[model samples]
Target: MPANTANVVAEYKDPADFYNLINSDEFSNDVGQMLKSFATARTVPGIYETDVSPKEVFTSPVSEIFRIKIHGDQAKETTARAEWENFTKTLNGKKVLSGVSINLEERLFLGIVGWESFEVSRLLNPFHWARKLKFTGSRKIP
Candidate 1:
């Protein structure tokens, strides 16, 4: 989201405008995470290939996903946090701990780091985490 872009999403409702937004590496990464998160939940490949526009966003809700235990002692906190949040919309401590299922069709959270990267494999079992998450609540770890 650009700082100067109109906050009124109704204004620039064109695919070209939305495509320009994809130029940001951050936005692309977020999309990638959303795809992966969708895969994790569905246990299948994703079907969609385009960005969801502001117009279509109101029609559906994204399924939530949680990946846990992803930081090492040497990692920077801000860097790690961005990777985590960028991968998914939900908060870090607010994990899907056994009931965050999606009957819909895809993912909303995504990542190349933090939870979905080397750090998480090093810290937790992917199978256990996947099976364990469902209906989750937030926790203040600090």
Candidate 2:
């Protein structure tokens, strides 16, 4: 079997907002910074800008999705929200998708870079200098 790559997600107040952010250079810059923050704060193997590429679709029957769960206190969540808002503040446009779900409980966040095959996924996500094991122990690929 081929190895699997992971993905990340974020919640938005409107679909238009999501699209606008995703399409902007500011989004790229902010996301690039966020990924670096994750690597530094979480001490996960750092991923570079060259290592990431956006995709239109992240889920499919054949896809192996990597799920990550963060257990933190409300203070941490509040901090995260502040950081996220700072990144998103660059979005100067209006909301496009109305009635978008903004509830914190209903949202998920995934960070992913699609790989052509499982082998590539495994190779890139090296842990202990071994390509056979998943790199980030916190993430589960099911």
Candidate 3:
């Protein structure tokens, strides 16, 4: 594994369970770990922020997915975390996680450096993660 590689997984028991996790320390801990592992040493460039499914965000069958695609050097991790914090802060205590089955996807990138190129693989293991996650309180390490 590369020194800059970092992986993170966010799991919620059920949609209701997600509410609890988001408000609890677990969410913060997970975010913190992601930042700690991926933060870049310097400011990166060519950062692009886009909303994949704009309408689906509020009307999707599954939970909403917020994805960030960045094209830069080592600082991408820190930048990503900052963006994530800003995005999540606007939830306004809404119930964003609720469903019969939840998918807590996790991924680890092994590279020569901390993201030398731009890559987004949220769909890598769609079926696998979707199958492993269920219920309302189980937590798994990624």
Prediction RMSDs, each to the true structure? 17.0, 17.0, 17.4
Badly placed stretches (over 4 Å) of model 2 are 1-64, 71-107, 126-142
User: What's the TM-score of every candidate structure?
Assistant: 0.20, 0.27, 0.23
Candidate 2 global CA lDDT score: 0.35
Give the true-structure RMSD of model 2: 17.0
Per-candidate Cα lDDT values, in order, are 0.32, 0.35, 0.32
lDDT for 19 (candidate 2): 61
Off by over 4 Å in 3: 1-62, 70-72, 95-142
Please give the distance, in angstroms, between residue 6's alpha carbon in candidate 2 and its true position after superposition. 16
Tens digit of lDDT per residue, candidate 2, span 1-142?
2235343545443456766765789866987677664443442222212112223323322223322222334553344344434433432321111111122342223223333445645554423221121222233244
What lDDT would candidate 3 get against the real structure? 0.32
Candidate with more favorable, higher TM-score: 1 or 2: 2
Q: Whose lDDT is greatest here?
A: 2
lDDT of 1 at 98: 21
